[model samples]
Target: MAMIHDSIVKEDVVEHKLGFYPRIPADSIFTRENVTARTKLRAHLNTPLHLATMENKPNSIALLLSMGCRLSYNNLDMSAIDYAIYYKFPEAALAMVTHEQRAKEVMALRSDRHPCVTLALIAYMPRVFEAVQDKCITKANCKKDSKSFYIKYSFDALCPQLKMEDGNNVRRKSENVPKSQNIPLPALNIKYSFKFYQRSKLEVDALRLALNDPKYRPEPLCVINAMVAHGRVELLAHPLSQKYLQMKWHSYGKYFHLANLLFYCIFLIFVTVYTYLLMGSSENYSHTKKAAKCNLSDPMTFDRENKTEKNNVFNSDFESKVAMYTSTVAILAYNAICLIREAYNVKQQKWHYLVDPSNLVSWLLYISSTLMVIPTICNYFEEIQFSAASITVFLSWFELLLLLQRFDQVGIYVVMFLEILQTLIKVLMVFSILIIAFGMAFYILLSKVGPDETGHHLSFNSIPMSLMRTFAMMLGELDFVGTYVQPYYKSETDILLPFPMPTFFILGIFMVLMPILLMNLLIGLAVGDIESVRRNAQLKRLAMQVVLHTELERKLPAILLEKVDKDELIEYPNNKKCKLGFLDLILRKWFCNPFTDDAGLDLVLESSEDYITAELEKQKRKLRDISLVLEQQHTLVRLIVQKMEIKTEADDVDEGVSPGDTRVVPRWSSPRIRKKLRTASSFNK
Candidate 1:
């Protein structure tokens, strides 16, 4: 049998000038008509042929081609033969070519030069099959029969295993075919059926495995449900929700009411306690008794005569009681005001407000509260008294100072102002005490000396009489009488003395001078405290400002450029900008500026190496210092341990040995030992 070999010759002609050329097969037929009509007729005929020629039979190409169909052929030398075929027969022309047939064609024509062609043919097969199965070729209206014949011939001939064994078998097989070929091809259908079941089984198994696998299970859904349940349980169990189930509780409103009630209670309690304490003091009793005797309504009516008489009558009398009562009232009033204000603030939800309640208004309230003590003082000291006025003034001043101190504790400025105010008040009180002491001393002097000896002293027997003299001296009014006194008779008072003798004498000798000295000391102390507080505040403010300025500087470049411009940020001079105040040299040393100007850069560069060297030197110094400190500490520890050891050894020796007994040492000085002693002594020496 003669073998009929069907070969594809693909030519990529630039133009479709359908003319017989030298490269064309002499017997080959050519046409310019569309390939659709031929493709259909061939498909109708070849479909049955393909079914009939089952069981991997050969001559499938020839059998189909013999039935008035043609295959695609171009000059065979073109590298893009497979691509050209695919491009020309993009429709059902490729439909008849199976994957196996396409694979075989690709292998047979494989070449480095035609790699794209092999890839194109491989890629085209599946697409062509899908299009054919979807019946999309009919939409193109090409020569379907010719296209189909070309596809079948190329597929079977290119597939070496499918080719006929003998050329004679091709004709015999076509001729022997029954004319009544109406039976459906079961084998052709069976091939697709097997593929369909295989794909379906794979899909089912994948679905089964996905459902069974823990990794694929819907854990998020389970967690979401659990969270929902937990949230519901929490909401149901919450006390706030239960308490305000019907009516929601506004915390602000509740707090306000409670705070107001607390404030009122505290205010009432303070007032009641203060009144009780004031009434119990001795000054209140004297004032009440004195007011009754004189039929007086106020304590202020008690004159100096009545005060002196009362002081002479009862040494522990009205002044002391008044001081105690005033102080107690002042303290209570101050605290009450603070508590009330705090409570009000808590109610108003303005807890951060730093307002002081014991300010001007509170001071007025404190002064008014002391009005209740008036009647008692007037009734007790109606007639005879001395100037107990200083005591009352001092008490009031002391009370104000104490209140100021409390205010200072609450706020710094208040503390500072109070401290200064206290210093001034104390100075005044000290001067007043000196005046009083001098007046008492004058009274003693005047009473002990007769009026004739003192040269007509006017009523100097009384404390008040002496107080007048003391005041005249304190006010510089005594200079008129100084000319009459022997000490001032020879003096020329034109030049002021550096240290006035009288002032120094009074300041030095008097016990009252002690308070003045203490007051001066307090002034110094207050000044020092203020300086410290001011420095701390300044440092804190400076630090905050530095941070603020740095942040602003960082953002300034961006703002100026209208974009994030890092390069234009402001730099520091000498790399010395620090978060702390300008005085902190250590922090300045550590801080560096990347955005330095030319001058700054020059300075930085000039000093950088030197600075590093200096830093190293500093570190070395620090290390040495640390080493010294460590050595000292080690020595101290060793000494302590030695002492401990000595003590322990002493204790052990005493415990182990008999009391009052001495242990003997070997003599080594005996005659037998004489030689040993000489050797031992020589070694010791």
Candidate 2:
């Protein structure tokens, strides 16, 4: 059945591409004399509009709508706009809203019990969204329909149901009767039958399934990500949205997140201590041995016992091993916790889980830690083990810092650094080609140059080395005289000669292009966007807060969730009058966001103020438009009254009544009526 539906949709797409469904002429469908007939015809032809919408044919849908086709649901209880949004055809959905002032209807339509705004959010149609905002909720409306802000349903409640059909057979006859006259006919079943279940999985499986299933969780996440990606964080700042965020945060979100951060800190400490011990062991081993490189293949030189200083770290291997083992246990415990979290995200977020950079780092650390756990590998390959341990240590701490970024207090700084880092990467990408060109040029020019004064090989002797040297030069380490003054060996004469003029010229250009030009350009670019970076960083921080809180809500236990969830408007304190615990009071005093010292309530209030201002502006524009319409109507009315008076005067004069005589006038031409009309015209103006 699914395959059939897909094939039909595809065929419609092909026909649309081939122009088989061209726009119908309005004259053929509707009479020029009567609009009532057109309305009746359009009402009957709404099925075609629904069909066009289901097929995702935006042009056909628009054409049908232009002919006066109305938006309505078919027998399946799903409307055309619902089909468009459910299938994620943005053009098809936008066509409906952008035409014939149908945005209100589209916004009002409910798909799978969720407001059209919910699905429309995923579509990210600005015009469609704007239409919904036209009727912005005021204080009165918020009080009246406050319950509308909270959705009392599970995530799967938003998923559209698919209908399936199957043949049924095998009839068993059983007749119901009174207590004294019961009868039953039992026989052998002749055929088989099947039952179709709409939703077979448990409620717990809904989120997990939705992660990978397009019909479920992805739609919700898509709306969120779309807003964030487009820098539409202001949408998330809606009063209802902020209330939801606050509810989630004040519930188990803050506690769970803080606990998780604390655990990670402990893990980092363990990793740090483990790395310190390893480094200390290596350092002491280095000090104990003579300053001579030993061949790895020789067993005699590899003996550590023979060349040990009295205070070598290996002398206390017993105590060191004990400490290492203790730290390893703690690290492993934290790794287990991390593994559980990763598994949960994988099951509930699917591919979305991997989008986070920290997840990748955690996986890398996980693998490295697992390899390090094997005693044999660590003992036999000490160098490789140490290298892996070093990376693991760095990543563990870096991941902790990233986790800390979820907190708004510390997040701004991290966000600013990320913004700058991104700018730096772009700058480097643009200048990379120039740097490589210089590196290659230097390698070609100075490859034949002999060792420098101390008999050390010149920096530009090899291609890789030349690139490193060129990059270093860009950082103000120009060894210009040292590099250019080197001599090239003459093989035949067995003597050294100085470099030619071309080398000096190349050095001068390198100095100009790299250290002098590129360095300053990078610095200036990084500094120029500091203000914008700070502004964007705040928005990004809010977006992160939204994502974090939403995810926390999803992870909450359903039973406890109902208890924690707020279904009403959150009334924030106007001032800091409420008392707090000693620890919280201290923390709030020191760690609150500087820009919003009143505990995020100020930010919420600001958002609400913006919303109120926008609503007022919209109302003002509407009133102005209405006033213009009334002025036009008043003008038409005055013109009709003037024409009537002119005819009346001409008739009165033709009838030979004295010009001074006042005959009984009709109420329509009375002074009172004229005066009222004039007053209305003036008021409208």
Candidate 3:
């Protein structure tokens, strides 16, 4: 390598062809085709760039480039530029990148490489699951352009394995041995060693150069979608990625939808089960089994009358406690994940912290659960505890309803409900007036009639009571005795009143104005919204989904939401080692295990050194015997040819033809033949 520089300064011993190309003396035994062009510790297809890369010598790379070596040309496996990058030779890679332009002019291009966008998506996406055998699409092990990439370390032919045994890479029987350094991917248009295309400056600069060259600018959504799909969360550092990732909540639509849907199902299940435990199945109220009954079931049954209730086989109380313990733990764990996701949402879309309904529901749940903690721990105010409990149940179901907004079919139901509710707001003023007037009339009449026999007002003790009764009537709770008579009665005696307490007022005015007129009129007005909602289901659902998508996008980690250039992150994983498949795992466990899988080359290397002296002598002896046999054969052939030539000359004389007219074929001769003849003649004597 130093010879070029050495000769340049010392012209006395230097020679040149055409005053430019270097020339060697006649004594030089090696030529251009020789495997070793003054090399050591090298393999087949070895070149100066490969040496520079392996040695981590940047100066050597520059030297080789000056010597007219191409960095981006097709190397045996990896082009030099890709090899440098894979080996973490950044300086070498940069140097090659500079020379790439000139290389294109010299070498005929074959194919193109995948741009940053395509590779980022492909690299990060999870491998598709296959149930049975997959013949291709492997990260390692399987042969490449193969006759079997690499050979096993076994006793075999002495010189070397057949050349055909190895392909572009060595697929050694030991799958872990990484034989191929090749990155000649099909997606690239392979000009100037297209493998280096991934590191091209164009991709990440798309945003920077957007104004100058519109074509260079990728869509904000495209960068985001690619980043999400490829899992290059680190790219959030890019300004464009940061801007779009935070705002474009609906980016990565399908993947985002699926991810949230899965998490939502899990959250719903745990929340549902936990809510059940808190409401009824908890062992805290086991003694009050009658109190233990949830609202969904009949009132708890107390068996105090029985001197002792026998324990059942299942010990229902203890089992219920166990269920409570486990469900509580699971709920806590899942809730933590939910909170983290929601917090991430707030970070990505700052406005979502206040505007998103799901976020609002999550905050409500947090507050309610926090409020219930004291009541639950002290074992008092079961009503307060269950009120919070009720909130969780309502929120869980409501959250699911919001998720339904994303479903194209059932999404229309959400639209209809919201539309009807919004339209009903217009009638609220009229309804409020009627409710107030009716309540005031009832209060005046009932208080004027005085308390019933129980010494309490059943019809109207206050304006609040009158209002509550009137509102209940609107819901068709028309049993005035249940609503007004029972509460004030101390033995059904409170019914004693002038003209029958609440019945006359309920019949004459309350029932007529509340349920019969106002309540019916409210429904009649909102009923008009259903047809309008049904007609525009698609657009309405889309709007709802857009809203939902924005919220769900906030749940993702900001890292996943960020944009990274595909090229920068392809080799992001430093190890570059691929994980093994099921078959490989099994084979490794059972078959064979070696210290270091040198792809079988170690055996040849070791054996040649160990037996070098003896092996050379043995080969020489074999060659000598073959040479002697060849000399004897040549002697016989030479004698036969000479006799034929003499016969041809005599035939020419008999025919009276000129000697020049005769023709003779060539034959062989050797001094070794005469030496062998003499040795044989002396032996016969």
Per-candidate TM vs. native? Answer: 0.20, 0.60, 0.40
Query: Best by TM-score, which number?
Result: 2
Which digits, one per residue and each the tens of the lDDT, describe model 1 over residues 104-152? 2323343233332323333444344332222211111234233221111
lDDT against the true structure, each candidate: 0.37, 0.57, 0.46
Compute the lDDT of residue 254 as modeled in candidate 1.
21
Candidate 3 residue-wise lDDT, 247-320, digit = tens:
23223543456567767777667667656756664443564454444432432333432223445524765675
Q: Per-residue lDDT tens digits of candidate 2, residues 37-58?
A: 3334445344666767867777
Q: On TM-score, who's better, 1 or 2?
A: 2
Give the CA lDDT, 0 to 100, for residue 98 in model 1: 35
**Could you give the C-alpha RMSD of every candidate to the true structure, in order shown?**
42.1, 16.2, 28.5
Number of residue pairs clashing in candidate 1, backbone atoms closer than 3 angstroms, sequence gap of 3 or more or interchain = 46
Residue 311, model 3: lDDT of: 51
